[model samples]
Target: MVAQLRIYTINRGMMASWLQLFYEHIRPLHERLGMPVQNAWVNAERTEFIWVRSFNDREEIEAKEAAYFASPERTALGDQPTRHIAKIEVRVMEEVPATAGVS
Candidate 1:
């Protein structure tokens, strides 16, 4: 299994709108496309949105992401958040089973 961590930096004064758009639109689209989100969080100042999604493998992740971004729904609603986002960072990670039970 693998996880994708995405961090989105919102433009000044646009955090609330961006979050709304993400949860109302983007997140559901992703979930329907097979990329189930594990968790979501905001930074202390609320300027950044961070989320994690799990996949069976890297290929699954790539395929789901490709389909999601290329879909008609995405084409229509995808840009809604772009204007509000200053930057985005994505990281693919593998869990360390050895530490699974360790706090």
Candidate 2:
């Protein structure tokens, strides 16, 4: 199992719209693609949106991402966020079993 930490930087004054689009559109699409969101948060400044999602393997991740980006639904809605998103960072992480129980 693996987790991906995604951080999205929203354009000035666009955080609310961006988050609405993410929750209403993107999150459901991801769930349909088999990547379940584990958690999500907003930074104190509110311009950054951070979320963690789990995947079974690298191959699944790649395939699902490709499918998502290629789908017509995504193609239609993807550009809607261009005006709101400034930057995006994604990190693939693996949990350390030894520290799994630590808070």
TM-score of each: 0.87, 0.87
- Model 2 lDDT tens row, 13-80: 88888788989998998898888999999884858989999998777888888998987878989579
Q: 11-101, model 1: which lDDT tens digit per residue?
A: 8788778888888988898888888989999894858889999999887877787898899989998478689888999999987798788
Clashing residue pairs in candidate 1 are none
List candidate 2 segments past 4 Å from native: 98-103
| Whole-model lDDT per candidate | 0.87, 0.86
Off by over 4 Å in 1: 44-46, 98-103
